[model samples]
Target: MLRELEKAEQKWGGSNKLIDQWLENRRKLLVHYCQIAGLPPYTNAEKSLPSFEHVKSFCDLLVDYVSEGHFEVYDQVINACEKFGAPCKAAIQQVLPKITPTTNAALDFNDKYAETQDDQVLYQLDKDLSELAHTMETRFELEDKLLEVLHSKYSEHAQQA
Candidate 1:
């Protein structure tokens, strides 16, 4: 769960600058997501139509989160594995591919929703967003697994490095 991740980050992130920053980013992204989901239908519902701006904002945040994971966090984790000379290097590589399904699902949702030009009431998107939420949860679990192996194990290995 997210709470476990926060604990892991707190327990393990302090020593590593990259990890500390990454955890901070993760917290921000998760909080914003919760806030977005909590708004009046919940916040900033001025239009007669469903808040497409809100949808866009959420989609944008999702992209930012994923981008940071791929372009920054995952790469840092890989580097940490190598730097610590951890035996999990190969196993971590294997784990990376397992994230593809969730990544593809998210990217597909982002692409589909991003191109919509009108203020459709999002009734159709409600079901789709719900499915995307499930996919995001899957993605988070996969990410946590990576952190467990990549951070906990590798940090342990770092002592021997």
Candidate 2:
């Protein structure tokens, strides 16, 4: 996931300030996730549950990232597409619907872990995180596709204008 994010940053880093910020947010979220999941450099040799503070912090980021994508990023992209005409509309239509399921999954993960006091919920954290990771991977791919379609069409329009 980290490697994929790095590639995305290289490809789309400065294409637009909004996208740059969004990708940076993704980088932070992924790093936090890795630490919590005990992957690689942040690995927990003891395999203990992550600190409650860490989990809460991650959940906060999770919700913020998701909200920004839905309310800010997607809206801007769609508005841009409309302003530039319909060249990318079909691709956007296709990608947006696919993104909804991922959003629901992410929100579900946030709800499950964001403010829990039960150890049983904590016990399920590993499995839930694994599932959320998969969902996030899918979401990122769809978002990239949307961005690619929008950027290509918008760039063409800009050049022609």
Candidate 3:
């Protein structure tokens, strides 16, 4: 996942300020996730559950990232597509609907784990994290596709202008 993120950054790092910021948020979110999940590099040899603070922090990032994408970045992209005209607009409309399920899954994960004080919840954390990771990977791929289409079309329009 980290490797995939690095590749995404290389591909779209400076394409737009909003995207750059969103990608940076993604990087932070992933790093925090790795530490919490005990993935390598962020893992210690001893494998204990992540602290409450770590879980809470990760949940915060997760929610913030989702909210930003829905509220800010997606809006900007949609507006840009609209301004660029029909082809870009239609492509984004299709992609945005596909992304909605992932958003729901992410929020479900956050609601289940965030602010929980139960040790039982901690026991379920590992499984939930794995699921969330899968959801995020799907979301990222969709987002990348959206960005690729938008950028390519927008670039062409810009050049022709």
Candidate 4:
């Protein structure tokens, strides 16, 4: 799957539609793998820990898939950011009604060591990838918030301008 993803990335600049299809296929493959591994989909946020080694392996695969330059996945990542923006913004949106502040403070603490400025060693390389994945996930979450605001404000700002 990683190999296919890399190929998609290489081909992405040449054909956007092909790249989009590849990304959609990648998402489907992820969903299928999740189901085959007996792991819950993204909606099952509460199921944090897994009982089996297979589940852990599957999670590792996802982390690897997300971390590498599966550059083709960038479009899907951006699309998800756009789609989830509203719920994220609504969680903190000042308009319509004020929403409660949910704590994401702990989220920042995850894999913080990944950002260390120390030189990378051989054994540390794999750990670095996992940490990078964590960092990427954090970045995507923040970008989603920004996209939500930009999209939600588009109409009002346009009218005013």
Structural similarity to truth (TM-score) of each candidate: 0.76, 0.95, 0.95, 0.27
Q: Over the stretch 1-161, how does candidate 4's per-residue lDDT look in tens digits?
A: 43444544454424345445545554554553544333444334553332334333444444444433134334443454355556534543342121011112212322332233333322353443345444434543443343344444544556877
Full-model lDDT for every candidate: 0.70, 0.89, 0.89, 0.40
Clashing pairs in 4: none
What is every candidate's alpha-carbon RMSD to the true fold?
3.4, 1.2, 1.1, 13.3
Tens digits of per-residue lDDT for model 1 on 1-161? Answer: 36755786867678677667766766665665555455343454553334567667777877777888889888977876786454678767878888888778878878877657754535467567668777777777777777887667755766867
Arrange candidates, best TM-score first. 3, 2, 1, 4
Give candidate 4's TM-score.
0.27
Question: Model 1 TM-score?
Answer: 0.76
| Weakest 10 consecutive residues of candidate 4 by summed lDDT | 96-105
Is candidate 1 or 4 superior in TM-score?
Answer: 1
